[model samples]
Target: MNCHQAYEALQGLIDNSLNKKELVEIKTHVRNCPACKAEYRALKMVAEGLDRMPLYETSPGFNKEVFRRLGLEYKPQRRPAWQSLAMAAGLSLSVFWLTALAAALPTLLMGAKAYKLTQWLHHPELILPSFQSAILKSGLAAYQTLGFAAKVAGWLLKSSALPTQMAVAGLLALVLVFITMRFFRPQTSL
Candidate 1:
């Protein structure tokens, strides 16, 4: 590591929190850079001094006394049983809904497909003209397919089941976003 990196990792080095590679790199940098070596020594001394400092125990009544001095009651708050039960029930209900959604998802998707098919069967004009022409003109095929998909999507969005489908899709999207954020988030430590 360079002097700056070595300097930044000094606390990690003192606490033995660095990996083997980083420890080796910082040690090498600190050995060569006189300024960094001095800084490392100072930090190490301070850490050692702190380790050697005596610990004083507080009396059991310390918290009570402080609260009394502040003219406040020293009460440790306790949550009621019903609040815990309500939270657990809410969590259980959420899981149940998600599970039910998972189970019903295929059926809902099939219904959507059926809607498009029915729309085509009833209103033949809504269906795209043969792609055989589109095939002959390769450049137009993608545009034609996109147009057809957009038409079907518009129809689906206008259907009576639109609200339910949107809600399910929204929930799934939120869950995916949350999962991505939770797993890929940056982690830091002292």
Candidate 2:
């Protein structure tokens, strides 16, 4: 198998998720490709290091202090698994959406540049240049115009992106506030 395939399968092979035949194939690829082997080793070390880390416990009276602040008296409630999951899911979804939107910025800029360059190329005066020097001069002018237009377009696009980024930041902040209120809101009773 090629390095690309080997890299993709590295996780599965390391985790022993693959059958013997597939494992042997991946192992062979790793043996032959030193780069893949080194990458695999680094990833394995990171995974192992994470696995070996110790779990931490909150200090005693943490829950009492939280409930006291919320003025809530402890009455056992059903598991809050859904709340935690919902918070994580909301954060993940927002991040994904924002990332996808941001990723479109470059494509948008390229499209604008291409469209402007086409317009510059097809201008009537530019097409009428008869001599080589005239044509060269026209082409140079078009290049400069294209550069200027692209700069303006880029500035406008960048300005537009600012509001989007701010909105995303505000949304993230609001989510953080809401999560803190729900999770650490002072309990109603002491």
Candidate 3:
């Protein structure tokens, strides 16, 4: 065998994994070639030293301590059940109030009338007339605007090439998906 082939097979030879014919070939090469012989001896010495070296034992909680030092140890806190329930209730109520206010915003703005807490509490009927008028005006405005928007949309849809536009939009959306995936995909070692 050539020096390169013999060198490559040296590990198998040392481990006694080579067949009898391959072993004989490698042995003959090592015996004849001073450079190959030196390399074989060095590799054999390293293997023997490694085998004879003492095995190491880590201290208890070594991994935990290492992770702690690296600032990666995670500890979760426990809270009382009542506190958790209260927090959830508060969040839900806040979201509900915000949504209600948003839905009533146009009417409220159009009404431009403020009511005192005492007056609302004493006579809620007094507030209804102004509020109802505001809601009616705002609804009519919204309806008109919606009709105009629908007309514009219908014109565009009728005037354009629907299939071609849809195909181009699909292609653009696919390209964007591909770009986002490429940008966010995890990197791997070569």
Residue-wise C-alpha lDDT for candidate 1, range 66-159, written one tens digit per residue:
9999999899657788866665665544454444444334445686575455433333334446554333233233324433443455576775
Q: What's the TM-score of each model vs. the native?
A: 0.31, 0.33, 0.31
lDDT by residue (tens digit), candidate 3, 59-114: 65677787789999645446888766766665544443333334334434444243
How much lDDT does each candidate structure score? 0.61, 0.62, 0.60
Winner on lDDT (1 vs 3) = 1
Off by over 4 Å in 1: 60-190
**Candidate 2: segments with Cα more than 4 A from true spot:** 65-190
How high is the lDDT of residue 12 in model 2?
94
C-alpha RMSD values across all candidates: 18.1, 20.2, 21.8
Estimate the lDDT of model 2. Answer: 0.62
Off by over 4 Å in 3: 60-190
Rank candidates, lDDT, best first: 2, 1, 3
lDDT (Cα, tens digit) per residue for candidate 2, span 7-93:
889999768799888899998988988999999999899889988766556665788778989998965456589887776766654
Give candidate 1's TM-score: 0.31
- Report the error of model 1 at residue 67, Å: 14
What is the clash count for each candidate, in the order shown? 0, 9, 0
